[model samples]
Target: MGRDTSSAMVEHLDFFQSFDDVKVYYDNGQNIVKQALDRSVGKVLSKVVVRRRKTSMAGYRLEQVADYLSTIELALVKYEAKEDGETYNKFFGGIGSFKRNWLKQARCKRI
Candidate 1:
């Protein structure tokens, strides 16, 4: 049978969710910081790759990239300050809690 990555990914989401909640502790309430870090790191990596290729920034100076990343960081900070905690009120109960409540009646061990 052909591998069904989508279904497999869905099945594995619980593992990722619990790890996120317990180990990383970011996906639920602190995604904005993650987003900013991703943006800035992406730009820095692109700059490195382009330099390695011996190509110009194509009218995008290094300073411009820095400025853009800084802008994204500032925007996320503003959003974090303005956002209400209600956004994650339900999520705080967490994936483990949901699984316990919903899976208590399941008869199959794998399912």
Candidate 2:
């Protein structure tokens, strides 16, 4: 039998109360991260836009958002790469490849 029994065996994993489903967790995580980033960008822009009044700062603000998102994505990739190594291997060993798995791994690492 070639069936993967490992995943069929349930693993006890706790998550934030608001996220019942993994997809929901991922979506909420992305939204929360973006919102926080946007707030930070807004604060910086409020100060910078005063002096750069003539330039179109809308495009520049968007570029900053994109850059921050890319940075977060890179950190997640690092977590996924770590999953293949020694850290938290026991917790994530048989979970397989899901984009949100990195979130779980990162959380576990922090605790």
Candidate number of the best lDDT: 2
Candidate 2 per-residue lDDT over residues 73-96, each given as its tens digit = 665575556644544344433325
**Ten consecutive residues with minimal summed lDDT in candidate 1?**
20-29
Separate clash counts for every candidate: 0, 0
Instruction: Point out where model 2 deviates above 4 Å.
Output: 1-59, 83-111
lDDT of 1 at 98: 29
Candidate 2, number of clashes: 0
lDDT of each: 0.39, 0.41
- Residues 1-111, model 1: lDDT tens digits: 113433443467666445422211122236666555444433433324322223345544655555545544444444456542443325423334423542332323232
All candidates: TM-score: 0.22, 0.24
